[model samples]
Target: MKREKLNEMKMKFRALSSNEGFARIVTTAFIMPYSPTVEELADIKTAVSEAVTNAIVHGYRSNGDKYVSLTAVMYSDGSLTVSISDKGCGIPDIHKAMEPLFTTDAENERTGMGFSIMETFTDKLRVVSRVGEGTRVTMTKRLSVFSK
Candidate 1:
């Protein structure tokens, strides 16, 4: 298959509960045209929601003063790349965070499954973080003609 490069879309929103839904909606709207099925849309939206939720709940701790950034890029091969980041309490151990049912906050019934869900939904997942700095999660999926 020939690779085709497309433009990228980037947006940043405050790490607030209300903005989470907006982020998911905007992302879905932008990628929906290339998505093949409703299942794919749900998957993408859920993955994005998980990422944003993590940023708001874990990263900003519901402060709502911080900001979360999202970026989407279409590759030449019809692959979609998404990046969600927050400058908050960084993950101490990414491997452990990615593990299912491992959450630092359990009192809230977090389930610690956010990372796992994101991983399951997207074709690729990458996380970058510092102890006290912040975290960046990038996910990718191949967009096929049948995806729509």
Candidate 2:
């Protein structure tokens, strides 16, 4: 079903590990007016952090020179959708990559839980990628408004 978008925002930043926090903060600020609960906010932040970190570490292979783009949309039904895209080496096997404890960089002590964490935090998660091209991770969540 299609929902009317109340607001939208897009940003592009260098694919640096340090920028992961920046992305999370920006996403939180964007959704603040919707009055999400503390738990909801934390979940979104964690998913955003994982998505951005994946774009920086796996997509770009820690190449700070690469770029990642993030787009967020707020729907009238209190749902928010966030998409993160990276113009770097894409996932060759998305299914295998998303499996638990499946890390291509095990030598780096990577937990291989990024996708799992994102999936757990968001209501819906979709990933699109092409080898040697790029990858885009889209996540959506329905926010339960908090009242004080």
Candidate 3:
């Protein structure tokens, strides 16, 4: 079936802890209208937060000099796709990194559950990265709120 017109938005923010909250807020604002319920909005927001946190904490190694980019596109079929990306030290082993509770940093008490949480919240999750290049996380979900 043909999809509806897509609504798109893009943003770039410093890879800093403070921007994690901003990422969540921007993601929620972008996807809330398409979400079926407030719970879905919350889920997506948390997912985005995880993605941003990973970029700051892992990708950029808490280096505020780098930037994280976020993009959201809303499809006519009521599905929304959001992508969070950063140009920094890419994940060495995507499969290992995706493993639940497997963190590279034990000193920081990181659970290493960002990818896991993103997968659970959205209908689709994809990761594209290259060591020494960067990482991009894309998540898609069909929202019910826009049906009516």
TM-score for each of the candidates = 0.92, 0.95, 0.94
Specify the highest-TM-score model's number.
2
Q: Model 2, 28: alpha-carbon shift in Å?
A: 0.5
Compose the digit string of candidate 2's lDDT tens values, residues 16-109: 8889989999999999999998999999999999999989989999999888999999998888999999988999999999997899998988
Q: Evaluate model 2: give its lDDT.
A: 0.93
Model 1: colliding residue pairs: 3-76, 4-76, 5-76, 35-147, 35-148, 36-147, 36-148
- Model 1, stretches more than 4 Å misplaced? 1-4, 146-148
Question: 25-137, model 3: which lDDT tens digit per residue?
Answer: 88777766654587788888888998899989999999998999999989988888889999989998999999999899879999888889999998999999999999999
Candidates ranked by lDDT, best first?
Answer: 2, 3, 1
Tell me the tens digit of each residue's lDDT in model 1 across 30-122: 887675477777888899999999999998898887889999988767678889999999998899998999998899999999999998998
In model 3, residue pairs whose N, Cα or C atoms come closer than 3 Å (at least 3 residues apart or on different chains), thus clashing, are 4-76, 36-145
Which residue ranges in model 2 land beyond 4 Å of their true spot?
146-148
Candidates' lDDT values, in order?
A: 0.88, 0.93, 0.88
Per-candidate count of clashing residue pairs (backbone under 3 Å):
7, 0, 2
Higher-TM-score candidate among 1 and 3? 3
Candidate 1 vs 3: which has more lDDT: 3
Cα error, residue 98 of model 2, in Å, equals 0.7
